[model samples]
Target chain A: MPAAATEAPTLDSLRRLTRAFRVEILRMIEAAGSGHPGGSLSAIDFLTVLYFRDYLNVDPKNPSDPNRDRFILSKGHCVPALYCVLAHKGFLPVEELRTLRKFGSRLQGHPDRRRLPLIEANTGSLGQGLSIALGLALSAKLDRAPWQVFCMTGDGEIQEGQIWEAAMAAPKFKLGNLTWIVDYNQVQQEGLTKDQMDLAPLKDKLAAFNWHTQEIDGHDLDAIDRALAAARKVTDRPKAIILRTIKGKGVSFMELQTAWHGKAPNKEQADKAVAEIEGGRR
Target chain B: MASATTGATRDAFGEKLAELGAAEPRLVVLDADLGGSTRTTAFMKKFPERRFELGIAEQNMIGAAAGLALGGKIPVATSFACFLTGRLETIRVCVAYNRTNVKLVGTHAGIGIGDDGPSQMALEDVAAMRALPGMTVLQPADRAETRQAVEWMVRHDGPVYLRLTRQNVPEIHEPGYRFEFGKLDPLWPKDPEAEPDLPSLAFAPPNGKPRRQAAILATGGVVSNALEAAKDLQSRGFLARVFNVHTLHPIDAEGVVRAARASQRLVTVEDHNLAGGLGSAVAEALAAAGQATPLVRLGLSDFAESGTTEELYAKYGLSASHIVEAALRNLA
Candidate 1:
């Protein structure tokens, strides 16, 4: 296992890693025959910065460490992004990423902790991650443990009422150790999140729920790093970082294309996507 | 004779949980705004730091309970049975599929939570919970059993769904009776010493002209009614034996087969829906064991109305007289 990055990687290096991961994400989905590629691509950059930038206190060797920082992908259909980051961190074999969504594979279609212990909780059904995250943060606060919980949710996923229920709770418990990152990729499985269900006034609603809020361009590695660092200093209230991202972030043909939200790229399209991602096309 | 001493199972759960909370530091309690009705206030009062009030949001409460369990805390999440199981998707993934050690306490089960009507009653909770893999479903019959079951639920490592009653239930077990998982609690012919050397199948007394015998399997809020039904049947020159089915998921299949062999017929009564409660479990057990024993199921066929507990029980065919009729069907 690689040692924890004592120093943050350069933004350029982080971008390079993100681009490589974007290609892996597309290839794995194409290999699986069925998966959500757009959201995975949109969330990969944030996940890359979060995992590689050393903002999360985790040990790949001891994935079950009680005090290790917890991460939950609430919008679980995009688990290809999480799997890519975890593989790179040595939590699981990088080669196993190809076996995703297959029979008897640890890389379940969704993040299943039972099959893979590195995942903090099983989440595929939407709007459940924040509550689980709040519970973890609340537990840590109860024990005065020096650990933080980070959860990532999609813009369309917050349509569930349970998200607000959890949003209301984290502030009530004063869970300052928890950080929620919303991958506001704007697009959803059906269409744009707004056309499906308007999450307009998203930041104001969250702020009214008493969360410390931050808004940033999700593709900016520096912005993600800064928001994570700011979340750590807040020891009295939970923090929510809203990452404005583009669905199908890197692949030009798939960018903002609702069809790319869940449909896997074909062999021809997969080859083109790899070329585009490698060529640094946005 | 069944003991006249009675107490609500939710109260027993609360008393036992508070005691367990004191003993187990890792134990945490979460409530969905029904702490008073579910009787978890006792736990909250004693262990203020350990108790979490998640308001009327049962889904979030369930998710948080799973999170706490993952964080190595024994979380007892409580709400009315209907509201708790209404979030079946969350439980299906977070608690059951995840195989997290979360204890789900669903009080006010079935029509027994009278006056609140069908909306508040969890008539299908057992069915929903039973469908989930690796979920332990328990519906203790009385105070003694509930206390023991609560203790066992905490000590056991896995997901558990404990269905409790809002109404008081008569004591069915004798003093010092132990609660074992996946086993039937024999209630009738109370004195074991008096029935020494009883035949393994088809017990008969001297000068008995093949006395008509039937076994009554009951669970949760209806076990006492079943005992009463048994007594009523015996007074009419028929022999009836009663067994309490506390664990509903990993049901006592062996005991069910034994009871089927020992009696001429079998009758199952529960406060839950007839489709997926004790009766369905017994029928499945009998079918799996290749027993063609005649069986009768007595429970709600539809949603119950708002009324007193006794009136609702009678209306829903869960009363003792109704149980006696069910057992007597096609048997003189």
Candidate 2:
């Protein structure tokens, strides 16, 4: 049986893993010649903490086990983060990350579960993943199963009407086993999310929906760990963590830059990004 | 005259779902706030634990239903046909492409819905549902057939869309009706077993000119009109055959080919848009079979207006008289 949240992958090591994920994501996106690196960098810390720190009950072998916890990448534009983390955890071949965005790549521009069975759904048409995860959560609740479902969505992507649709539903179903982590990087593809469309008082909006809401620094591994632990104790309402993170978090030049939301870095920029993460400088 | 004998297909869908709920443990129903309209609430009332009422959110409901299917539950998601089919992107990516075992029930299909106007009428639902890969589209002719198809849908393994009507229709089948996927039900002569091609003799019209034999292929509530038109044409000394096509996607191409061989012309009638629906499917199938038989497509060529079902049918050329007129005009 895989460890569940209280086991291996200590906090120190998870911090190290997050840095490595940042490097891998940048290099992979650069190699693919196209992909969203800003969102990938912004969301990697929470994904690393969730997947590596024994928080999720997953088996690289036998992924379809009925009792396994489900993970849905609602923010699918940043799948490079997920690909790198899954590879490091041995769910996929590490060499496959470079082939992303290529023709016939299992890793398409968006998630295609048929190509990669470990993927729960074909997402990236933003605001769809939460609903898919809600189904898994609702099913587990119906069967009285112990598995919980985790989903991650981008801050700007939540502006889609369907996100609110899924948001309003999960709490009504009293899906306590469901947790949605909002990667509130504050920057969308066009510009800063606040300028594009203000999502101020986002926590209150989610709270009013009857969700157990929390605001945390998304880049902090310790805070992510604590928030996830707290969410597990929620009994009657779904959990929503508004994780405030910086776009292109680990790279100084790319940070808070809207242009980096989708573009792949050149080899020169890729070298600088990898060096920054390696040198332990934000 | 009790309504049960001529009840709506959606009513049959709801009633059969309740019966299937008792028989199938894995069966679950989900609705997008229009359970009352879609007729899924009957099962919801009986098996409340298995029912999920996702209020006013069709996309989420569909996506969730896909997840439920993946999680080993046979989920039936329901809404007004237009609203349910309007969420094509979610269904396309999540359910159809995933090949999840989801039964999508779209009630209040086509202009038969009456007065609710084009927004509610799913005139193009079959067009959208048929466009998806692995999505089986079925629209029953009446109560018995709807019940049988609903029961079969629970047992079928992949994605299926069951289209139903709000308006009550006359029960067309007998008590022991069985729905076979990809098979067409012959209705006009009341002969499901008859080869229907017994009219090989070249018949002359009233003016004494020989013309080709013709057949009407139809589905849903408009089928009764097709039956009437077939009778009228036969009485007028023209060979008329009618087939009620329940399964629209994996349509009985064999039956269509046989009918094409038997008749020189085929008129496909439906209460939907001319594109991507029953007529389009039949045309594609016949063309793909390398058959050059002429065809007259009968259906809504434009958006519908608020009116009675009969009024819409007449104005849109879906009435029995229109079918007869189309047969007289084409079938060469």
Candidate 3:
């Protein structure tokens, strides 16, 4: 239990950390018996890089620091991934990850700010985190603070009209301090996103709404780092980084499987999933 | 009851918001593309930077309002009461649970928004806002009360719902009226006589317009009408009085108890529906307090007709004539 963050990890080590994050996410969801695994596994690399790498100006001891960079999980059902990242970063105890979605635990089924002070807002309903992020970003501008606000949206969740509403509003306010990263996992509760309701040519749609749009491989930690850094310097309009992601990213059985979206793997299945995640980095 | 001047609570809200904006730097306003109708344009025009236009996105506007409040600003989010409460889930989580200093101003309340019909009406807003824990519900009776409520709400430091009206209602209180939270303002019969002799009670002439047998509790633009109805009943030798129930939630239970004790029957009138607004609040209070006064909730029982406000009120039995008729029926 180190009080300070460890030394900056190299690309190879970051890849290892992301693999560890995926394993922990699988273990946590398996332990909880009810959790989001597909989205959590898919977004682990981006989250791992943001929190563990040389980015994200957050102090674990001072989660409520007014000037701290803000991250909102708009796809809040994937909080298992966030909980893993927070715990690994000392924002939470790693031992408590198994208590997710349990009775009388801080880790609820969805993101609850009251339950966890580090959470920016309660965002289970989807498509709402971007607007709140814009709000926090706008506040930073108003106060002349240098903090940034980042909101992660699930690909399927963008179908909500409020997402477009925020997409349209960010440019109008010229919210340079805000960045919405889309976890384009291509899988949702019902089925494949393309089959449910197509969000194809998303880059054009985001560009039309006047955002600085970028597309990248979500699993590439270096690409994520570069994209996030580049997006931060745009300072003219709000940025949207479209991270092309596989639904179940790491585990061999779970990878690219939509059925794994919300269901927890059984004990043997979880063991295999963790073994595959841990072995993949080898 | 015809006053020299009439005012829309929304119009006064805009002016007071602008006034407050000039003084309070952290006071921000968000409009969901209804700036013109919601009267947030006044504040927007004055403080463009401070007033954010969310462009027909009530959910986003509400979320942003909560965020801004979290960032140390008083954010007032405005829209048609229907649209604002339509995003009740967002409000339920971001504003109510987070306990941010976000003042949600829902104008065009009830069926009084005229031709726009039920889609634009906020008949169910009171029920929704009141359902949330730690949410303060305040509906102003007139221009004075509206301004006072807005000013007080900006400084109150919590989640509040300030319900305003689209129609022009006559000024009920004096210019210097102060807005009190969770307290009913005495508006009719000045002061009700305490415990009149029930034994010596004389019935009015059975031939003329019957007697008033209840105290009318009302809110919003209907307050003046309830007062007029009470005065009209007074002319017919009925001892009915009216109380302007501005704060619907945390409703002054003492006022309901007093009103119930003063009359044999208690009538509550609002432009809202028959269930879950002023009526439900009053009924809950009286039942909990064990007041056995017969209650009559006067509001639209079914969907409202798409007509002028006056015509709708007449049809829904929320007009002054309906109040008089109900009083007569109750007394009979």
Better model by lDDT: candidate 1 vs candidate 3? 1
Candidate 1 lDDT over A1-282, as tens digits, reads: 121245757778888999899999999999999999999999998999888877888888888788888998999999999999999988899999999999999999999887888888888898998888888887888899988899999999999999999999999999989999999999988889999999989999999999999999999988888887777777789999999999999888888999998999889999999998887755
Report backbone clashes per prediction.
0, 1, 0
User: What DockQ does model 2 achieve?
Assistant: 0.72
Could you report the DockQ of all the candidates, in the order they appear? 0.81, 0.72, 0.63
Predicted candidate 3 versus true structure: per-residue lDDT over A1-282, tens digit per residue: 111146767667878788778888888888899888999989989988888774688889888888888898999999999999899999989999989989999999998888888888888987778878888888888888888888999999999988888898889989898889999999899899999999999999999999999999998887997897788679989999999999888777777687898899999999988887777743
Q: What's the TM-score of each model vs. the native? A: 0.97, 0.95, 0.94
Which prediction has the highest DockQ against the true structure? 1
Question: lDDT per prediction?
Answer: 0.89, 0.87, 0.85
Off by over 4 Å in 2: A1-7, B1-4, B191-212, B330-332
> Which has the higher TM-score value, candidate number 2 or candidate number 3?
2
Q: In terms of DockQ, which candidate is stronger, 1 or 3?
A: 1
Worst 10 residues of 1 chain A by lDDT: A1-10
Query: Candidate 1: which pairs clash?
Result: none
Q: Give the per-residue lDDT of model 3 (tens digit) for B1-332.
A: 43558989999999999999998999998988888988987787888888888877899999899889878889999998899998999898789987888999999998888898878888888989999999999999998888888888999989999899999999888656778878888777654454242422233545564444577899997888798788788777786767899999879998788778767777899988777899999999999999888888898666775899889888888888888777767476
Displacement of the residue B141 alpha carbon in candidate 1, Å: 1.3
